[model samples]
Target: MSLVYAKNDWYAIAAADEMTLGQQRQTLLLGTPLTVTATDEGVVVRDDQGKTYPYQIKFDHVWTALGDAPRALFDIPEGDEPGRRCVPCGVVRVKCSPLRAVENFLDIAHFPFVHTDILGAEPHTEVEPYKVEIREEQDEVWATKVRFFQPKAAKSAGSGITTEYEYRVPAPTVAVLYKTCPPKPEAQDVIAIFVQPRGEEECDVWPWMALYDDESSFEELVQFQQEIFLQDRSILENQLPHRLPLDPKMEIPTRADMTSVAYRRWLKKRGALYGAMTEVA
Candidate 1:
């Protein structure tokens, strides 16, 4: 797999709390060196050569791009809704391709095997049929009416219940999940994974949430998300081929993998080749 990246896009490299006042923090995104420093007014970002870059603070992280002409970041309307508990679960560095991480996040069929009783259990291993499609208007992949039985859907969940979910992939490196909120039955809980490409086979993933729960503490919420992702990290680090294979022949897909197939096609269509294996010349 070649180390290629779509440079003209925003990626979350560091947590908002990481930028200490007047202290410069540096990192690598898509294999480019970048730095950030906190100030009284705002955060300042610079390249390895000390040249400044455009940046914004959203979803409790600093987003910036390496390419000179970059695409605009997507908006998360739920981030502003009143009474929603916005939680940043922090970052987890994984030794796997960023694209692979996003693909894994879009899958739920592994719950019964990987997540076990926490997310699913035996006899409830079947993944019901769901609809997946690419929305041309937004250039995003969407999966609707996804339902699964969970032993504990969330930290606030008091008992096992069938959970309804919707998945959206707005960017090549980001995945947004909308699921049923236990407390607010009429509303949904939004959880997202922002992948910061560090190298072809490495990335720093940040999980965030906008929930309607009032029962779980901030620490509890963060811990709950961390536990699930850490379990995923183990599988991510050990998968063969490191990068994702866009060629369907490289790896077969099932009905449950429609979102993944849609994602690969979307990446191919957009030429977002970082951390991917494609047959296209």
Candidate 2:
């Protein structure tokens, strides 16, 4: 996992709000040379060789599945309190697995079963029409779009209305999506999460929330989404492949496995496509 993480490619470190301007800190994740600096215009990432890349803190959690040991580097200024270490890069790297399994989870069809409690459709429930899009390169890398029809009375009454929760992956480990209610048909709410694979079997999960109408509302949403991530992290890390099964018998995916099935099929096709292209070339 660590080897694939390019020192040159722009990788997400932390949220912009966490670090102020003109501040530099050193971190250990992704190697000891990692350094993060905040400038007036924006943020900059510097390698050991003084090579710097200007960037924006797009995701809240810096996740990786590089090496066998997963670690998180939180940039705490030197002048903070006692027992505080300033993490220049705020790069949290965990070893969960390669980026592939993470991609499979986003398939709308899998939510109904794999993650039944938090995200899923009841048996016999038809999923609202949604499109699987592969947009621009810099577009949300890992993304999902889903919508479901729900009864209006059940929604406002806090009756756990039937709704669609769509998640889009914009990077190797970022999830961005919308959740909506009836009457107010607009998807005004968004949840963005970053999952870094630490080593080969662990992961660091960070989640942030924001409203499309009000961006600043991210403050409270951050806390709310973080808790949900905590729950997800606990379950994901415990399950095989971090909530995925290497062997089907251990966890059988049924009709609700549509999403996972689709994802697997896509991956296979991608592999074949790339393989043929390589051979032909």
Q: For this target, which candidate reaches the highest TM-score against the unseen true structure?
A: 1
Q: Taking the tens digit of each residue's C-alpha lDDT, what string does model 2 give over 165-228? A: 6655544444455567333455334544454433334444444443432222334434433433
The number of clashing residue pairs in each candidate reads 0, 34
TM-score of 2: 0.56
lDDT of 1 at 100: 93
After superposing candidate 2, which stretches have Cα over 4 Å from the reference? 1-9, 25-33, 39-42, 48-50, 57-95, 98-157, 181-183, 196-203, 212-220, 241-253, 262-281
Q: Write the per-residue lDDT of candidate 1 for residues 168-240, one digit (tens) a residue.
A: 9999999999998988889999999999999889999999999988888999999999999999999999998
- Give all candidates' CA lDDT scores: 0.89, 0.42
Per lDDT, the best of the predicted structures is 1
RMSD of each: 1.9, 10.3
TM-score of 1: 0.96
